[model samples]
Target: MEEAAIGDAALFHSEQRLQQAARVNDTATIRELIWGKVNINARNSMNRTALHWAAMAGHERAASLLLDHHALVDAEDKFGMTPVLLAASHGNLSTLQTLAKAGATLTARNRLGQTLLHCAAVQGHPSVIRYVVEDLEGIPVDDPDQNGKTPLLLAAESGHSDVLSLLCELGCDLQAVDKESNSALHLATRRGHAELLSFLTSAICSDAQNQDGLAPLHLASQAGHLSCVRTLLDSQCQINALSSRRQSALHVAVERRQPPIVELLLRANINLHLQDQQGHTALDRAVRSQHAALADMIIKAERFHARSLGANGQTGELDLTLRHVGDLSRVRSVLWALATRHQKPGDWKKLALHWDFSAKHIQALENQWTGSDSYKEHGYRMLLIWLHGISSLGKHPIKELYEGLVEIGSTDLAEKVRRQANAEQEPARRCVLM
Candidate 1:
């Protein structure tokens, strides 16, 4: 029993040395070990043979020597990574060629069902990828692994622009998706690859959605990838494209608290009125998520966009910034104070009626329910919408506010609001007074 244990220990030592020698490309030491009749196929702690080390390190000559000594080229490591897979993953074209010439199965897949082409694409090796696709028989460029991820998708996920370009040039399917139905564009956007996203958007339809019905724009917006979001918008992707849940990219941005992306989408004339499957607009999402600043921005955007459409009767893109919206920017605080501090519950609906606000407009504003205080938000939103319309026509907001309040029988409140509007306070003082 003791002798057998000694023999096993000696074999482990020799195998460790052989792996070490192969790692450093020490051909002389490897040859000496081979001459001593060391077991070439013996595995170490990770089940990796010496050939695995040689192939991974790109030691072409050492790999050739190991193959000639009848080493197991297809021996899988603990992760099922064979010598050929190791070579391909490390971008060792010469070592891979050596393995291929030694009767190694070039099409052998790792445990994840990833082939040499998939590995090469992930590693950004165009040459190795080309060799695998062009030289290896029956190896399709669009072949999928266990997760249905093709080499093109893998390359896109890893942000390998050159490999992706080559794959596209080789006629790989540009619209191919993985098991989750995520396309290369979706993967690139999720990973925040702006340059790669630009390339992909130019190649494929930017509005292509994943299994979740999320387009690249939706993913970019939710992930807070500002450049990627801009790229998708510039590519003319459907700005108001809804997901499976019927949520637009705007809704996703607001829900995820992506302010910059939200601001960018608003500039593209995205539909602020788009409701999710739960019937919540982007503004509703912002309000529900307690993102007060984001909610305010959406309200401002919605008001201006409506005004622009009503005035022009044209649906072309319009920048909805505060500057483009006009004089309402000056009295935003006065309007806020009127809605939050002065107006009572159900008062906004009466004001809406007085201002000729359509039932649809009133309903849209009241759609969000956040308890009894919901009326405060509803009134605030309605006030902004009314202010936008009045400002767009170049009308005096103070005069309009006084008239609207009198029509609703709030004459006393109207006098106070008008006085506040006419007060010659500094900008800081105005904010404090409101």
Candidate 2:
């Protein structure tokens, strides 16, 4: 029994070495192993024969030697990957030809239902892709895998523009989508392939949404792909296009802490008033995330747009793309400190009333409820919104801030704010609403 165990161990080591030899195309060791009467079709832990390794590595000489020794040509691995399928997947045209000539089925699919054409297209193997679709004749170029992703869709998912071009030339559907309804354009944007996204945008509509109702712009913004976002915007995609959750690209960008993307989107004519399903605007997201710079940016843009609208409801041509924040924005930290620390729970509403804020604006500011500390958040938002209105009218925020505090009967608080304002830098010194 011990001798039998020793023989079994010798054969196991020989098989492992045979697999290693086939992997590196060392045919001498393979010949020696074959002559020693080892099983040519011995499978490893993954049920992969030596032919799978040779074919996967494109070792044509090793593959042919094994086949000549009566190796199984159509042996299926754990993934149902045949030798021919592995050869095609690795872009081994010559090795694939050898397997095909050995009567290996070219149209065989893996467990995911991916054919030779699908595999070749995904790996950007143009020659193998053409050979499988044209020479095989039975496989369809638009054949979908288990996810309903055609070769073109897979090429897009893999970010292979050349493969996509070839697939398009071979009559693969440019408009093909995966099971999630993600088109080639959506997939390209999700992967942040700007060049591929640019090519795909021309062929597909940017308004197309996936199952999540997320447009390419939304994905681009959330992924922080600046070039992709620029490409989508330049392609005439909708700027304010909302998702299934009623969240715009701005909302996603803010929630995902994408400041540069938020800056870019703010340059466009986006609607700041658009709320998500949870009734949170992009400003709400920025505030909740405690990002003061991003919140101030959105406030500046929001105020600019609100002021630009005329009585006839036509928007003005004011360039809101100025990269720098103005004088009022510099006082944001002071305002936030006052709102969160100094002011009482109901003091912000009283200050808003003193500033003559309409019921609608007050209601919008008071919509969210985040426990007892929610009052502080509400106070900060109210201060920022008031600052927006004052800055838009070219009035001084510091002077108006003191007068509003005094009118709300916070006389000592108003004097302290005035002293703090005077202590600030030149930018805050420019606050002249006095």
Candidate 3:
């Protein structure tokens, strides 16, 4: 048992010395430790082999000595980063080459499912990425990380043009998509990388769809990339390609309220009425987005198209007027519906009184009902006289009316109506016409 304790002590001492040597870039100390029969693969408390420590510290000479001593290249530290991954992340080209030439499998993935290429690409090291892509041919160039993003996708997203070009030249499948059904084109468009987008558009066919059934053009439109949109349109790409949500570029444009993009798409003759997965057209999306101007434009365009069809038109003069009235009626109906649905008696009375007391209709009623003196006495005398007074004075006598009604101290039913009338009078006063 004492001898076993001594062996553990010796192993700990050797690992500590290797760690120190790596930190200080002490090549001689590293070689001497291995030559003196110290376990080259001995791990520290963190489970980091000497190669892991050396690579992490950017100590190429120490790392080479450990590699020469047959230390495990893919030995993971507690964090699961192998020596190759650490070296690649730190852009240690020499250490990476030594580890690779020592038969280190470049495909070793950490807990993140990130291979050495992923690390290098994420670190924006074009040379290290090139080394990994070139030297480690067995590593799948298009193999995705946990996020399902390949090295090419990562490089393009990071705007590492050189690395991106290399990946493309090596046939990295520029159209490979991530977990979001987002392709390299999608990422480039979303990141607003115009140069990378141009390259990908020119180099790769734009028909590649992501998980969303969205081709690159759809993504470009969704991202508001006008230049990318133009390029895709010029390529005769499917301008109205729909996503998994059945949303076309026109739907995305209207939803985003991008007028220029919408105009460009409209010019491209994209189907303006394309519906989404929810059976909502682009006009519906526009209305939902509250882009009133764009919605009006689309509505007018549809109306114009329908009118051009003559008698067989979807909308004739009566249909057009009805549609306009229907829109206004719908708005007013929603206000009334909300009032009734929410049990807002005050709102209901205010709206009802506003519509009832409108000057045009009230004057017409006064003129039409003047023949019956009883109706005239009730409507013309009371209603017209009060309306004339308010119109001339520009204020409803709400306070006077409240005081008069309260002074009478009427029955509970009359008092309730009076209170409701008083509660509704102020808002109605604002709507009163001069």
Measured by TM-score, how close is model 3 to the native structure?
0.54
In model 2, the worst 10-residue window by lDDT is 316-325
Which lDDT tens digits does candidate 2 get at residues 1-434? 99999999999999999999999999999999999998999999899999999999999999999999999999999999999999988999999999999999877999999999888878889999878777877898888999998989888888888898888888878888899999999888988889897788888989889999999999999999999999999988999999999999999999888988988888776788899999988888887777766776776676566556633434444333322226544578679878887888888989977776655556556666778888898889778767756654556677778887887789988877876776675664444543
Off by over 4 Å in 1: 1-8, 307-434
Instruction: Give TM per candidate.
Output: 0.76, 0.80, 0.54
Q: How many backbone clashes does candidate 3 have?
A: 2
Looking at model 1, residue 11 earns an lDDT score of: 80
Estimate every model's Cα lDDT from 0 to 1.
0.84, 0.84, 0.65
The residue-by-residue lDDT of candidate 1 on 1-434, one tens digit each, is 99999998998898899999999999999999999999988888899999999999999889999999999878999888999999999999999999998999877899899999998988899999888878889788999999999999999999999999999989999989999999999998999989898778777888878888999999999999999998888888889889999999999999899999988988787887788999988877876776766776676666566666676854444343434344454578778888888888988888888877666556656767788888988888777766655655657666778888888899989877877775745565443323
RMSD each, Å: 4.9, 4.4, 13.9
Error of 3 at 270 (Å): 3.5
TM-score: model 2 vs. ground truth? 0.80
Q: After superposition, how far is residue 228 of candidate 1 from its true place, in Å?
A: 1.5
